[model samples]
Target: MIVAFDFILLLFVIICAIAAISVKDLLSAVYILGAYSFFMCLLWAEMGAVDVAFTEASVSAGIGTVLLIAAVSKTKRRSKD
Candidate 1:
């Protein structure tokens, strides 16, 4: 395993997690969470856990993202804040 690559992915995962939580927009947060999931998938794949990577890609980054986006779309765009 490449240490530098792992660190890069870990950094991205942390950034995405922070961005997802800090963003006020629901859709943007969902997208960021999806990115976080993707980065986690990459990390798992790099660590030789292809099954985990596939599951993360199919579940979190895939269906979870779609569902979250659809739910967000159903909400009012403008927030009271």
Candidate 2:
């Protein structure tokens, strides 16, 4: 059961990573990267590294997301293609 849960989380992380890179919109990519960071935190917690997970959650998913969102918000939206 735990293995199955881990697999599902891993799948989500992979999807988020791909989506973050593939998305053209800066805001959307930042949001997806935040999701990816959250999934990584979960994966670390599930693997029994609570300390690492806490750091990932607090630093990456929390503050990092906010910073990225702010950066994206300050930029003018434009399509390259």
TM-score per candidate, chains pooled: 0.89, 0.88
Q: Write the per-residue lDDT of candidate 2 for residues 1-81, one digit (tens) a residue.
A: 289989999999999999988888888888899889989999999999999999999999999999988887888644453
Q: Which structure among the candidates has the greatest lDDT?
A: 1
- Can you write out model 1's per-residue Cα lDDT over 6-29, one digit (the tens) per residue? 999999999999998888777788
In candidate 1, stretches whose alpha carbon ends up further than 4 angstroms from where it belongs are 78-81
Largest TM-score belongs to which candidate?
Answer: 1
Mark the regions of model 2 whose C-alpha exceeds 4 Å error after superposition: 79-81
Error of 1 at 80 (Å): 6.9
RMSD of each: 1.7, 1.8
lDDT of each structure?
A: 0.89, 0.88
